[model samples]
Target: MDKHIWEEFVELERNPKQIERCEKNAEYRSMQTIRHTLGRCSYSNKQYKLDEESNVKVVPKATTDKWLMGHQRPDGSVHPSAIEAHKKVLEAKEKNKGKGLSSDDHLVSPELEEVFPCKRKDIIRGYSSTMSKKQCEMAAVASAALQNRDTDHEERMQAIESTMGIVVGKMASFQTLLGMLGGKVDSVIQMMIANAAAQGPISTPSPEKGSTTYPAGVHSRVMETEDSAPCTLDVGQPVQLLDNVGKVVALGSIVAGVTVHGRKVKPNERKVYIEQVYDQKALVWDAPQGDGYVVLSQLSLPTWLIWAEDRLVGLLNS
Candidate 1:
């Protein structure tokens, strides 16, 4: 956090509400300092009943940080999900293999932003007295515009997870969705596959694009390359689909290819296609909106739309 902001956090004297807030802010700052400076949480000093062997940092459930989700620790941090939290919650995963341990029990680091949530650029913009009326209004409007989008994202992700189950299960609904459009999206899918096949093996999720776009909860079934860490796009910002988007497009292409081939897509075939998809460079651009989303440039069937699995999906009709 900036020095000025830290000072402001220290000096907020108003009514009961303001005083209460100031106390919380000070506590948050103290926690952050201990976590970073000591390389562990203050709570980690004591022995817990759960894991007596290893003393690990524990993020307690506090009313103050209820809204704090794991976005910042995402840089090389283990995902909270059972699948990705490869590091065992206990001593080590390998030591207790086949114990049927549940996912949530794993010990993961608490997400700590370099700045406190109140001190973040977006949230602070509204609270800052220095901002003009127009700036605050614009910020509010942007927030309002995000509501429907956030809802859609949550719904789509839920549906996607339910459909894909565990790892890569048969997306029968996506297959059915494929048939509903008939031949509408075949060309696009075909072109994407041909391009990927042409390029052969390449790195996935190039760093210039910063950290993985996948949220903490998601089990990123998509392949990740050795050196390619996705860009750290801020929350609610436009997704950068132009970069490292081949794998998502490839998922759609393989399913669509089954429709063209007149046979049920096999599981092994799906795995092969998915693994190879990330090895090639992606050609993920050229939408009229210029946001790198997958929207059909042509208007063959106005009623239906082509949607990419992991990336942004835009609708175009002309």
Candidate 2:
């Protein structure tokens, strides 16, 4: 997934003409667009110059980088491929329940079985039998209500599950919409910028509220490689994505945000309304509530459009 995503990103640079237009306005923000599309971010190389900014290197995402690996919820943690391996093993185990296993017993991915084991007993078992306490409380209340209405336990549970499924499905759809909406907003901004460029140079207004500036020449390469950039992203402010994997994780291949002074993400704050770094403000989503949104920097707009269009933006869920 990560490799394919990088291919999608690299497709932008396939058209040299797009980056060419950007060089005309090789201001820091303009140049940042190139970095953004390459899936680079600011603060990564605070001390370093733009040229030294790190790249994801357009390779298969490293195992360490994949978010699912060592997924640590209260229940437990699992390796990146553990879940799939476990599911496959469970399927094979159940399917062969009465049969004498032969070649069929080797159905589990050998690599995964080495760690997770094919037997159910040997498999890592941290599946939570109950939902979160809050959810369980809600369930208990629903059960009582249904009991009052003379519904059987099974019927009450089914009713609750069905209703929760519907709500969750809608939420998921809304999130997908936000991801697509972010793409649309970016396209519209790019269209405006392109139109402006066709007529004349698009002036980059001074940052209405100041943004973080680089210190000395060629900021430290260490900062770029390490994710410890000292910045916080807040609401209603613009942000450049530092890592492509983040969008892939948060938005699930989401093309994705911060606000107070308009830079740096606040601790534990995941959602922020995305704003164009060039434009004053825009309405899109009423309010941004998820990381599935990506607001492209105006400069990266042209290069990204090629990739975006290639993404078959039209086929995206309406």
Candidate 3:
């Protein structure tokens, strides 16, 4: 019996197809071996043979369980499911052994490091294990390049923020300086007007006829048809004597005995009037007041102001 079993095993080893089948499907190989052993059984000097015409013959239910028991491990234990799983894993390994990294492997190539910097060390190690020295060097170069790019990006952002802060500070300081100069100019203009009035209508040279030209020192100029026409101030127009701008809420002649009001005004200390009603006399101007009436002539719009109302509106809408 031992000699017969050894002969069968030798025959199976010689047959390359049977060996392949055994590796691919161990349960089928075991069943084939049992069927071959059963074919060799003799009763009354006659061999008891199974049907050789059919590749898939139905075995007795009792014998099926014994044949399908699967191979035993070194510990002399059999688990068909675990065996099948292990066979599948080995098959997968053999299929991918000689070939390069598969898409499912998710191996980080040197080129991919630029875009996908976060690569698992386990994956990297697996890839590197099979790589040549040149390939490893390339991967190292790619990693260094990615790190340098990140560092440069961080540095560039920091530089941009610092530059922006400096620019903003300078702009604020420039605006403050302009406001101070504007206040001084307003005082000088008031003093000049007062001196001119005291000189009793001294003949001042008239500007060119039909010319819409403005003086160089003035920020804005608006020509009116009549000198006595009530000057209209618009919202967001900066007052010449005040530090901040004003918005016009209402328009009308001030009624007699009706006191004008302001944020920084003292009781009966300030007054507002139009040239047509106030006998062409100007009043003393004060600074740092909020939301008050002012003649249009006393307002000045800067020719080169940044972050203007129109720009702000467009930016907000965009």
Candidate 4:
């Protein structure tokens, strides 16, 4: 019997007009009771009702009238909350009216006036020559204050840019030094290997099985090689996706499976490969496309790659 009822429901759902008619009927039935007693707030258009306890409560559209008050015409008054807020504002103004000008109302300081050089004629022309003394004073003060604020803001911005320039210069110098050292070391190693080969089949000692040497140069070489190689993504490799870091969870012939920003990849979506990785958390590339697909050749090395390489070099050197 349940199966029969479910089949009937499925049939009804498959017919768009039938489904829409049923929805309309259901909505009408739901609103029938509410249309009888409750009302809507004139200000908010939200439904309200006077419960049996004689207190007003917000309710759904199916349980309220068109207006909160029972009267045919709305008085255009504010909501209770707005009324209370207005009252508070008026009270505050009344309390502060007798107080003298506060700090914010004061004219610009003497030192700032010298820097800003307010023109009395400009202020008078800004409004009118017959302007009150207080009005003229306020205008001059405001103009001076605006000028001071703009000047301060520009100085602060210049200082920040100068500081950033210094930091960037230092970083570039450090990177240049590292590159020179790496090139020298690589040349020395290559020369030693060449000389060893010239001496006739001498066996060279290799680093331990799990140990690595000169990881910074090695990483650079690996990245170069990978850039030219075919895309080889596998499950569990960390990928920088468009919005978040995610691990490759599945592989497909045409599409590679990946979770993006912690969201599971849905079936039938095209997967685009960014790159292969040894570490699951390597920040090597910018995030892939938001839909998990991207043009492979268009990607560039991420900004974090240099920092990662430096860190690896530090660890290897230590």
- The best candidate by TM-score is 4
**lDDT of model number 3:** 0.34
TM-score of 4: 0.21
Global lDDT scores for all candidate models:
0.34, 0.33, 0.34, 0.36
lDDT of 2: 0.33
Clashes by residue pair, model 4: 38-64, 38-65, 39-65, 40-67, 40-68, 241-287, 241-288
Give a tens-digit lDDT track for model 2, residues 154-253. 6789999999999999999999998979978899999998876676522213233222233223122112222221233322222333222111100111
Residue runs of model 1 more than 4 Å from their true location after superposition: 1-126, 166-318
**TM-score against truth, every candidate:** 0.15, 0.13, 0.20, 0.21
Distance (Å) between predicted and true CA of 128, model 4?
Answer: 6.6
Evaluate residue 7 in candidate 1 and report its C-alpha lDDT on the 0 to 100 scale.
66
lDDT of 1 by residue, 80-197 (tens): 4222222222233323345653323422212211112333343321112223223323322332223334666889999988876944545666678889886878878998999877
lDDT of 1: 0.34
Off by over 4 Å in 4: 1-128, 185-318
Question: Best lDDT goes to which candidate?
Answer: 4
Q: How large an RMSD does model 1 have?
A: 32.2
Number of clashes in model 3? 0
Global Cα RMSD, each model: 32.2, 36.1, 29.1, 27.3
lDDT of model 3 at residue 134? 29
- Separate clash counts for every candidate: 8, 17, 0, 7
Error of 2 at 257 (Å): 57
